[model samples]
Target: MLVLAIFVGAGAFIWPQLHGYAVTGAAYGARVACSCRFVGGRALGDCRKDFEPGMDLITLTEDTAARSVTARFPLIARQTATYRDGWGCVLETWRN
Candidate 1:
């Protein structure tokens, strides 16, 4: 029926959104992050790759005046889990 088709279509569109919300909610309880590969000496490129679409990422170095090797990363996961074999590890998030 046409009504059934419309219902299915609506469900399809909401499915991804519902899944994303659940994942992001779960990620909010995260205490640690899995480190990824680094391209340059500085920059959070590794962490960025692990980021989900629609997710906001902010990384800051330990010291602004001093040249350091440490960074603090804050990520907001928007998508759900994505597993890539070659990428090494799997990330639990929603695509931002």
Candidate 2:
């Protein structure tokens, strides 16, 4: 029971930080992938090569019809970015 309690405490402390990182990672991945796919004319699968190190947990999906990319960090966070003619890639509005 002590070990379980310790794990719970550790999770409580770590979860917020982990969620923050996931949110940033997801947003970055979505924007970068969107730009890569739309502006650079690259395949969505190839866009993973553009991610910074330590972003391996982020995964990307594309809506070609919408010219948008969505990135997810497992169950932690998800974000979408869409390409605009003049604005390049723009992130979706965040919702509470």
The top-ranked prediction according to lDDT is: 2
- Per-residue CA lDDT of candidate 1, range 26-95, in tens? 3431211222332223343444555555544433222223222232223323321222345522444334
lDDT of 2 at 59: 88
Candidate 2 runs further than 4 Å off: none
For candidate 1, what's the RMSD? 11.0
Best by TM-score: 2
Can you give the lDDT of residue 8 in candidate 2? 100
Error of 1 at 38 (Å): 30
lDDT of 2 by residue, 1-96 (tens): 999999999999999898888888899999999999999999999999999999988989999999999999998899999999999999998532
User: How does each model score on lDDT?
Assistant: 0.39, 0.93
Ten contiguous residues minimizing lDDT sum, candidate 1: 29-38
Instruction: Tell me the deviation in Å of residue 20 in model 1.
Output: 0.8
Listed in order, each prediction's TM-score against the native is 0.29, 0.93
Query: In model 1, what is the error at residue 22, expressed in angstroms?
Result: 1.0
